[model samples]
Target chain A: MQFGPHLLLAILEGLVTASILSLTAMGLSLVFGVMRVVNVAHGEAYMLGAVLAWWVTGLIAGHPAAGFVIAAIAAPLIMGALAVASDRLVLKRLNYDPDRTIVATIGLLYIAQQTTLMSFGPDARPVEPPFNQRIALPWLERTEEGWAWFYPWGLSITSYKLFVIAAAALILVAIWLIITRTRAGLLMRATQQDSETAQAFGIPVGTVYSVVFGIGAALAALGAVLVVPIQQAHYLMGGEPLLLSFIVVIIGGLGSLPGTVIAALLIGLSDGIISVFFSPTLAKIIATLLVAMVLVFRPRGLLGKAPA
Target chain B: MLEATGLRAAYGPVEVLHDVSLTARAGEITCLLGRNGAGKSSTLKAILGLLPPSRGTVTLDGAALHALPAHEIPKRGIGYVPQGRRLFRELTVAETIEVGLMTRGEGRETRDWVLDLFPRLRERLGQQAGTLSGGEQQMLATARALCLRPKVLLLDEPTEGLQPSMIDLIRDVTVRMRDEGYAILLVEQRMDAILDLADRAVFLETGRSVETVARADLTPQTLHRRLGV
Candidate 1:
């Protein structure tokens, strides 16, 4: 059997898509793991990041790369602060009640979305690239018989997609290091395992919760900034990624970081490949059905252990 | 080195400790003995700032602790091992001890000292605290508290589910700490063990102090009758 150039491109695109999806879902997973809150507003945070990136680019006169850098850094910091404020003012007061936190975050999602809509309007805005249009991969060339193929530049890939992939990989590695190597990571894991016990160890568990929430929000914001150049920024852009991120989180396992990354990649690649072969509507159905099956077969997720 | 004056606490409307007054002298083990629900744990919670006293004060070396948050309470030269041996389940014994040193602004040296105190912990350092047997977890909990190098230590129901050998180890550790000039306040339902370790004892009933007994006068039968065990 012969795979066409388009099919190969679709596969590469799927990998890129998975990277974006994983970045967003990783944030949601982190919050859920440590704080046990769904953070329904996460998607809205991502949307806000994209809009902010676009806005920053506009302000700087076509400096989209700078916008990306600024938004990537600022979005998380801002969202993290927002998360801390939310935890202190609202979520913390709920006393770690899962149900109440869920409801409150859902309300927060609406507020964040509507606020962005009000500020940015409903227009889909495009972010200009700061870097010059440099083609990293030459166009694919086919043999005269139209049965064999080769790449003129040895690789047929977009520089933008490559940049997104590299950025996402770097972010994931940074997150992994923070969660595993640092004292903050130890406190985070302890708090996630049992908040009371962590507190008993003289850790300010409340502070850990706030910081974790902030970090999670920041990751979501980073994802938004990364995706802006590929997909034009819009107010409603948060909804699609939110659903996909949730599905990825669920399929990966609620509180497991490694599981979340794997699940994100799986879902993103599958969704991309399916959409290429079929319609997006069908792809969504397939992805949802996969999630449901995973839930039924292994409620704890593919790599997650059952909650104690 | 630690004092509680006119301390009162409650869960919702039901008061658990009422105007409880006690003092723990440096280099001595002071035990609070009461039957279940007699506010023994509540006193420990109040001291640790887990449950804020509605009225009165807790002082360590003449500094007020009532206004401090739970996490900050440990920084005031006080360490707490709650009733349930509240070790982080997913963390290893070493990591569990490491968390105790978090607010101390100190480093691994403190953890090394603790590990030396409970040498059993050295062998099981990498094992998850939760996966340990109940007795090992208790050891880990106390060792973790010691990592803070606290001036005073609080233990709540430390011998709740321990075997005889483990209980003896805890008793020896308590006595050693007391002899080393560390102030200790212990809440224990195991009257025999508490009597064996404590220099003095206070009994509580219905959330109020009922009596104080000198350790010299404490016998198994007397404590059994007093505790109604």
Candidate 2:
């Protein structure tokens, strides 16, 4: 049981990290892929989700499940609305210009962060998970002198973490379904390919940009709501999610969802194992260094398409 | 009818089309013939509002087209087959055409007609358009535009890089669309395809429409002789 328990725990932790990372990164990738807009405020959107979840849950105290459920449903919707308003009111006015959007989103990031600070107060708070049952994990140990079969080692995982993994996966699948099986997806892909032609053929590129921005923010918020139970929601919490999503997106290929998912798993697993074995700072340094190599050698990221 | 009057367009400060006026009526195939850099494409872009003409107006069936955003022009019943057959290389032929349908908020029937026009595309509907040969890509581009089922179809060099057989197919489709009452505006470098299909030919020389010839009065050789090129 020497290394087995440790490995299992690390892997479980990695999977959980990957679940939220991919969810957040996919939104970033999709928004860039379609609208060619890099949402600098993506992390702020995540914080907003956690803040909204806290607010929704606060509305009905003493009922953890109801609060979680209401927050789950309402948080993303509110995040989506906020994103749409930002796109129409800010990004659209800037003509969705790439350089301008970056500045605009940076402004948005601060606006969101400060708004929460002014209204929600500058404090870290935790939301109660709807369920928190512990499930024991099994691991094999070395007998007195030889190897033994698998045995229980008191290793366990919380039920809410399992829900995070399942929910993230379901959302990813739903996204894949929409992107691959629906007409709206076709329009998005078309717009991504040639905005002028997409427009000439009947797509309103501006409207598509607004919708994509909204979806991107909503997905990020969904990931935040799911994790708010385990992680404390704070005004300062947006920084790490934002930084990690950028790493994932850059390493996965700026506009590639599949690459984002794979890179997320790679980063998350390594981050978890490295943090456990070494310092979290060392884990981060290694990840950043790895990204540097990918940039130098494979500029397109792990699975990004080469420019056509 | 699609009528563009005194269209003056520019790329930044350099003017491309100067006071160019033309018309493509429903039920006719009108060809815009010119040499390289002759402003034929610019004229089409101006009418489609992609260039946003610096002067004059483009009206489709009497409503303003130049004032509409490029995306809204198609909704007003104008379809375009841009030069280079700009298909989304990652998308399947069906998905590419489906975009045309989705933009108009219409569905399958137009797809059926497009597939009928280019049965070659029907077999390749599931294939990525970039995987196709040059000829097949041209067909997809034309098919995508036609699937929009526009009152006016703007084709910019449909026969460029295509084989002779593919040329015949595009020529045939152009004539068919004309007979079916789709106003077609085509830009062509190939005199043969122009002669084979154009009901009226407008010769553009250095941003101006120099002469307009009816089908009966036009001969590819004589037109070439007249231009003295």
Candidate 3:
């Protein structure tokens, strides 16, 4: 069992990364697809989620699950509200114009980063996972006379990590259902396709834009809350997710939700496996290079159509 | 009365409409005819609040339409089928039509009415609008607008690039809408169609609305000689 346990562990870790990445990247994709704006401040929204998760857990003080559950509810709602405010205060004023909103979001990113740094301090804070029951993984090995199954040393996954994966997947499914099944979802799609015509039909394009922006930020925050336990929450932590999600969006197709999720899976799994075997830096570089190559062949990204 | 008085609008520096005043009364189809760049489209856009007029006012039943935003204009019971029948290409027929009922409480009745109006749409409920033929897209756009249950309807070049058969269908639909008590502002260059359908015709020259003539005073020769088209 030279690398059997290691391989399993890497795969498990990769699944976690993919799940979180999908959530964060889907937000980026949704915002871009609908509003046609690149939100440079997406990472800050994610960071805010993590910090709030930590803060909410601290406030509710009785039990880990109780605190975690409350934090989970509060974080997304708060982030969604903040996102709506941001849209009204900044993006909407800019008229969701592509160039202006990019600059606006970058400014927002700094404001968010600095505000958290000033108030929350520069400390990397941790939140306890709801559960921590470690389940050991079995490995196949050639023992003396015959091949046998045995527990390898350090080859176990925590129940909390599994929970992270499951929670992220569930949230993603909810997002899918919202986009596909709901009347509001249909409105968003119509707005995304043609805002002018959408308006012509009384689908308030402005309101839809604000809600879409809020949902996009809310999704990012949800990912951060789920992952804060595993990855410490820090003011500087948003940069990585922001960068990675942008990469995923670019590779997947700008504004395409399905493309974004698929791209997230590809990037997340590769980032995980590569980080385990080699280096995280190398994984990112490889992901960027792969995206470049994909662009050379399919200019609109994996599933994105050429801009109309 | 969907009325505009002294409407002047522009895109940045270039003015497209100059004092373009016209009225589309209930139970009548008012058509705008001119050559390209004649501010025909601009007139419809100004009425819809898509192009905010720098001068003058638009009123519906003496209520200020110029004060409303583009989306709110539709809620004021004004339905617009823009130039080129700008349907949401990726949206399915059902989704596209449902958009019209966004401001309403329940869409089932309106949806049924839309399906009834355009039976072709009933068959392609799940099909993407982009995949539909041009004529079908025109019908869908009209259906989407009609589903709003608008007091006034705006049609921009509904018969442009359509076959004679499709044109006849659109003309029939326009007449039916007029008969059903919709005040319609139509922008079309098809003189023959306009002559047959319009209750009044306002001809634009360059950027100014030159004159408004009742349908009685309009004919192929008179309309053609005035514009030199």
Runs in model 2 lying further than 4 Å from the true structure: A141-154, B12-15, B216-228
lDDT, model 2 = 0.88
iRMSD (1 decimal) for each model: 1.6, 1.1, 1.4
What is the per-residue lDDT of model 3 for residues B47-166, given as tens digits with 9 covering 90 to 100? 888888999999999999897888778788898888888888988888777777675444798889878888999999999999999899999989988888889999998998999999
Backbone clashes under 3 angstroms, per model: 1, 1, 1
Best by TM-score: 3
lDDT of 3 at A51: 97
Candidate 2 residue lDDT tens string, A1-308: 45668778878888888899999999999999998898899999999999999888889877699999999899989999999999999999998889999999999999999999999999898899999999887565668978765646656789999999999999999999998898788878888888888888878888888888889999999999999999989988888988899899999998988999999999988988888767788878988998999999999999889877
Provide per-model DockQ scores.
0.58, 0.80, 0.72
Q: Give the alpha carbon lDDT tens digit for every residue of B113-198 in model 1.
A: 78877888899988988899999999998987887888999998898989999999988888899999999999987666776677
Ranked by DockQ from best down, the candidates are: 2, 3, 1
Q: Is candidate 1 or candidate 2 better by lDDT?
A: 2
Q: Model 1: what TM-score?
A: 0.92
Give TM per candidate.
Answer: 0.92, 0.94, 0.96
Candidate 3 lDDT at A113 equals 96
After superposing all C-alphas onto the true structure, candidate 1 shows an RMSD in angstroms of 3.0
